[model samples]
Target: MTTNQAVSVAVADRRPLPHLLVFPFPAQGHLLPLLHLSTHLATRFAFSITVIITPKNLPLIQPFLSSSSQIHPLVLPLPPSSSLPSGAEHIRTLPDGTPSAALIHALSSLRPSILRWAKSQSNPPSALISDFFLGWCVNLAADLQISHVSFFSVSALLAAILHPLFLSLPPPSSTPVSVSPSLPSFPFPHLPSVFRRYVAGNPDWDFTRESFLSNSLSSAAIFDTFDFFDSHYLSHLRSSSYASGRLFAVGPIPPAVPESDNSNIFPYLDSCPPNSVVYICFGSQFTTEPALAAAISAGLESSGVRFVWAVGTAAPEEFNGKGKVVKGWVPQRAVLEHVAVAAFVTHCGWNSVLEGLVAGVLLLAWPMEADQFVNAKLLVEDAGVAVRICEGGPGKVPEAAELGRLIGEAVEEGSWPALRLKAAEMARKAKEAVAEGGSSFLAMEEMVKLLKQATTED
Candidate 1:
């Protein structure tokens, strides 16, 4: 070959693999999904991923680190500040009733540290991919001259519903927004608690609101959802002026957790009959109020349904000898995958909701805060796989007797057969998405292709 040919080969071989600097908001619900995405970007598409974290969150990413070589950690200590308790690196560790805005405000201090780290690197990241909670990263990406993308841990249905608000439009009118003729629209009164609590010009409310609004200006946004849930919602957002043809739905990805020695727990799980167990958990952050826990136990006992409750705080002592009450870690995905678990009592956090969907278990949704309220709506009205028990947010305890009647009816043999079919069908659709030539598989390809393209053009 001529010298010119050799030079061409040398230059082409030196081209860098597209690198993404990912920042996961420090909550299990927020962090785990991004870790799954980071692993997907690395293993599935061969992109180099550098995830940002404070010191305490390293353990959370440990499972992913041991599995993939392409993803690296950029740990920066929080600069000394009295705003948050020391060693409170993630939201799950934050004291209950701490203002939601406090952590967001505290985290913004890391912007300078991240900026310095990126500058010191030899090959700058191709783009910055951050959780929607850290919407301010759009500016950080601008400073580094990299494309900015926000990853939403919520559903596309919620994203489309909130698009107007994200663009600074008026609150959705009390009339239900017509999402689809066949499915129920989340009327203004039924909208998420976060949106309902909006107080214009209030300092704390404005701060949180702007964090959400800043995401609309991102060059691109990713949703942890798939077309099977709502193609119309996905299409609407893609066509919206804010998204401008840059929205990717590559999800229903399962959370990563440690391997099971759940054999100890399975004796209880094993003793239950097929589709006879009700599995209850309220996500990572929300501690169950003691009275509410007792009320739930009362209801479960009244129904005479065998159950497994993963109450993070304290389990009700009254239900002793009747059910399994776990006060510590339970392998949620593993437990849900079991045949005995027929229904899930959940907070409807997107991650937990997706896990239940994939397991083909019915969701007994009790949305407390954040996007959970909207999630419950989509499951009950749109997806037809869930039944909402009560949703007044946290501290709105329901009457135990009424809750029991609902739970018993929901899981009774041969009840809601059509709903059960939908749940099972959703599970199959989830599997199909990962199969070759599926919608999500194709979307994943396009997302990676575009990310690489953006890197080259920049």
Candidate 2:
């Protein structure tokens, strides 16, 4: 080849990699999926990633950063605000009854610093991808003249229910409308129930709604859900006016948990019989109240089932001989994937639900707040992969006897053989979707292509 042609070829081959700035909502659930996405972008798409996090969540994400040279962690200062406690930068660290507005304001206050940092970057980020809660980033992306992508770490089912189509539905007679078993899917029943019971009472509900609306104005959205499970809801969102931009279902987004990292978390699992223990945990943000915790403790003991419970705080003395209590952060994905774990007693957080589904464990759905209740309904009533523990609203704590009965029923083959079979099938599909050339895999590729095209056009 001629010298001029060789020089041109080298220049074309050495094209600069796209830089993406990712900002998660600063909670464990939010941080995890985005972190996984960052890793995927780095390894799969060869993009440069800078994940922005606050001081408090730095520890949780530090290990991931240390492991990856391609992905960088940028720690931003938690803005000083009287609404939050001193050093309270994370949602999990914030005291109970703290207003959601306070957290939103605190997060919003960081915008100037974020913009300043962006301006100081040697090669400005080609795009800004943020958790849907950080709606301010959408505007910032516009100001920076780069592409914006909103990441919703939620199910498409939950998304459809929360969409304007359902939100605009007429109210039921009851103040907090109860979800009847016979409620039809068309026209979206039980939405008022969701609003009155979960959204209306939540201090930050309005803030969350506004954030979602703002995020809809972005270039596109990414959901941590798979096609087979969420195709119906995905179609609904695409047809509806709520989703303005392209919607991508590129998930069952499992975090990369190294086997060496959490080996010590569940040493007792070695002794337990295969698929014999029920693993229980709420997400990072939802602390099980004392009354419910006592009920669950009593229930687990009475059922005579081998169990591993991650209660966040110390387990009660009652559990000392009967079962294991994981006080600190256990490697949840690791625990779920363990051979000794038969079932998952969960709070129905999307991440936890996806993890349980991926692990092929039957769920004992005990929804705490927000979309969790809706998620539980989908799992139990619609999907048939799970059974509900608490039938009433969030206020109704499961009694010890009821909890025991449910626990026993979950493990009993005679009672739920069909359900168990279906759960196994769902797990298989979840795995397939994320496999090479699978539905989620293709969707992820499409998303990356769109991002690259947008960056090039900009």
What lDDT score goes with residue 399 in model 1?
A: 91
Please give the CA lDDT of all the candidate structures: 0.79, 0.74
* Residue 280 of model 2, lDDT score: 85
Worst 10 residues of 2 by lDDT: 179-188
Off by over 4 Å in 1: 1-15, 166-190, 196-205, 255-263, 317-320
Tens digits of per-residue lDDT for model 2 on 230-249? 77667766766444748888
Error of 2 at 367 (Å): 1.1
**Candidate 1 lDDT score relative to the true structure:** 0.79
Q: Candidate 2 — which pairs collide?
A: none
TM of each candidate vs. truth: 0.88, 0.87
Which candidate wins on lDDT? 1
Give the per-residue lDDT digits (tens) of candidate 1, residues 1-458.
54344335545899556789999998888888899988878766667789998899898898888777778999988876565688877777777655556677677788888889888988789889999888888888889899899898888777766655544545558576554443446666566656666767756556667777778789888888888886777777676655456888887764433554643668988887888888888887777877787788889888877788887786664364657888767788889999898899998988888888889998888988777877887899888998888875446888988988888776688888888999999999987776678777788778887788888887
Whole-model lDDT, candidate 2? Answer: 0.74
